[model samples]
Target: MDRPELPLAQLHAFLVLAEELHFGHAAERLGIAQPPLSQQIRRLEDKVGHALFARTPGRVDLTPAGRELLPAARRALAELADGLAAARAAGSGRTGRLRLGFAASLAFTVLPGLLHAHRERFPDVRLEIREMTTAPQLAALRERRIDAGLLREPPPDEPELKFMTVLSERFVAVLPAGHPLARHRTVEVAALADAPFVMLPRASGPGLHDRIVELCREAGFVPQVAQHAVEWQTVCALVEAGLGVSLAPAGIRRIRLKGVAFRAIEPGARTRVAVAWRADDTSPLVAGLLATMSEAGPTAAPPAARPAPR
Candidate 1:
């Protein structure tokens, strides 16, 4: 069924004139002349089939109908303004929901800085952050389950994903608190050549896991396997338990953990983390977030690796 069109212009004039009670003042407020303001009120009253105002030679006052409409008019205008604001915000990508998948380890690294920057610029954009390993995050992006992701380097064979590097940090060795190697500010990877290595499973973050192994191999001897865990925190925890020493991202040193010692690795082996999104996705929110990251850049500085808790 068709609805009756509201005479918004006339209603606005009526509200202004009602508040001022004088046509000249109302017209001045509306940036119009008094003749047009009176005509607008007359048209509105005719449409309502009620005498909205009882006008005297020099005074005007609202009738019962005009009084009843004042509150509704105010509410309608407020709702319309709110609706327009919401539309503008969504159009500019300043507000709305964005699903983001990230590697679990990034919580301590670049993620915090990136999130803070985005929020500072677009506080209304709701971010749904999920922790997934790189492979799963890539799959999620391909399946359209998430809008974007932060993960290790993309697979060489996958062409559907686009990525931008946001961080690169060297690897550090995490050792048992009392281990002799912890006394050194820096240690050669070959020094841990025979040391049992705690590591993440191959499937958890293959790029990083294999990179650690590759670093070990480059040092002239294969690392002896000691223990394997899924999360970086767990890997550090195992290192703390004296289960085995492990090589982790230098950022992991920022995590406050007891019984573990961190030391810089020789030759400064570094790994990268990047933001990834589907190549075909032209979502403004995703674009906006990428722009924010570009502006925020990397965190100020990576903290120096420190020794065990004393």
Candidate 2:
């Protein structure tokens, strides 16, 4: 079966008249003269083979056909709006869903700003995120599950993924308030050379964990990694138990922990955080987030680690 052909100009005319309910008023709203508005509406009614509006000197009512076309007309205009919006967003580099993967720790920092800016500019877009270790983030990026990742510097000689070094987050010694280091305003990694440590899982972010160890090694001592864990909350919990101290990024302050004491490390030592994307996926979403981060600030500065609310 064939469907009736609908013209955009006709549809526009009908919609404007429908809204105004008066030929003169509709023309005024459309910024046109009354005669043309009337001619267009009449043409639409003739083509549709139905009188779309019932009229009298002082009364206006939508005929059954007009009533039915109203919803369709509204939908047509809405879709046109969405299409135009998608185009504008893409041109300004803010459209599309961004599948972002990040190391659990990176999410505590600048990534939030990237996401916030993306939302402010393209509220209609879908933003999906996943938290994983650098290894998984890299793998997911390769597999196309994520458009970009927040990760650390790549080891020497692998140039497949496009990456940019954004910031080198400083290492902060996180301790329980009662611990010895808590009393010091600033402590060096050398000071904790022989101290027990709660390490980020080697599988999750080995670069960061190893970098902390290397800092101690530079001080000529080895760190005693007493516990291995993937999440920051666990490290803080272990610290609260008086088990060991952990080195976390400046953003770690967002976690509110009763027993945790986070202090800046001496020598300005820190882990590098970078943004990476598949060299080919140039989706507007990925580009937009990075662009947003370039201009925006951090999302929410957490007070301290109190477990994520239930």
Candidate 3:
């Protein structure tokens, strides 16, 4: 005693014939013969267990059941059409969710412009942004906890990740506004050789932390660490507190702590910010974002050199 399935073709025929009220006209619109159209309507009527149309020699009209089914049939077809369109849009990367991770400092540099451009081009794509340091960003990318990451100095040897540098900036010295060196427009790396340094722990951003240490060593002395902070803002805050001096990417100058000053460094070293994703990721959402980044180009404006604090 199972009920029969209602075929879409029969439902479609029913709606068309219901509107035309004539098998000849409905069949013409459907590009089929009148006999087949009649057969489809009869099958649909059988499924609904009622007569859908009343016919005289020259007239056709809907029964009460047919009238009731009209609105529901129209709504069903409309909903199906909408669902198909949404699926196609998601497949083409025009509408979907992207979970993105970024270094906190990038909010001052490449991230804002990149995100704006992506949103402009794909307004329906939802972006979920997470602030993370380089190390954790990499780990998250590998764990698939994120779709992509904007990080500083991604390791070149990570075989499972793909990276593209989006920004490169020279190292700058961060010092207390009241420190004598802050008066100089440019400070040599060697000037801070014996000075205690406020630094990010190597664990937070190994590539950048190690590079700063190497730059100091090249200048003939290892930086003596006095304090550590996990974020650039905190490092700048510590420097402003006169805890110790530190070197950071020029982009860090954007933090603008009233008590902190940024100065160009000599024997210049540069750090890079890159976008990274799993090597195996083939999701169209990731591809779309990567394409947008490529179109935008790696033209993030470098931090303007700041005048000495008076």
Could you give the candidate ranking by TM-score, starting with the highest? 3, 1, 2
Please list the Cα RMSD from the true structure of every candidate, rounded to 1 decimal place: 3.3, 6.7, 2.0
Query: What would the TM-scores of all predictions be?
Result: 0.82, 0.68, 0.92
lDDT of 2: 0.76
By TM-score, the better pick of 1 and 3 is: 3
lDDT of 2 by residue, 209-271 (tens): 678778778877888889987788788889888899888777777778888888777765756
Which digits, one per residue and each the tens of the lDDT, describe model 1 over residues 120-182? 999999999999998789889999999999987556666898888888877899988789988
Q: Pick the candidate with the highest lDDT.
A: 3
Give the residue spans of candidate 2 off by over 4 A. Answer: 1-93, 153-157, 296-310
Residue 273 error for model 1, in Å?
1.9
Q: Please write out the lDDT profile of model 3 over residues 1-310, one tens digit for every residue.
A: 8977778888888889888988899999999999999888888988899998998898899999999988888888888889999999999999999999999988988888899999998999999999999999999999999999998888878999999888877789998888989899889999998789999999988888888999999999999999999998999998888889999988888897899888888877788888999999999999999999888766644753577755
Off by over 4 Å in 3: 1-3
Better of 1 and 2 by TM-score: 1
Error of 2 at 262 (Å): 2.2
Please list all clashing residue pairs in model 1, or write none if there are none: none
Q: Report, for every candidate in turn, its global Cα lDDT versus the true structure.
A: 0.85, 0.76, 0.89
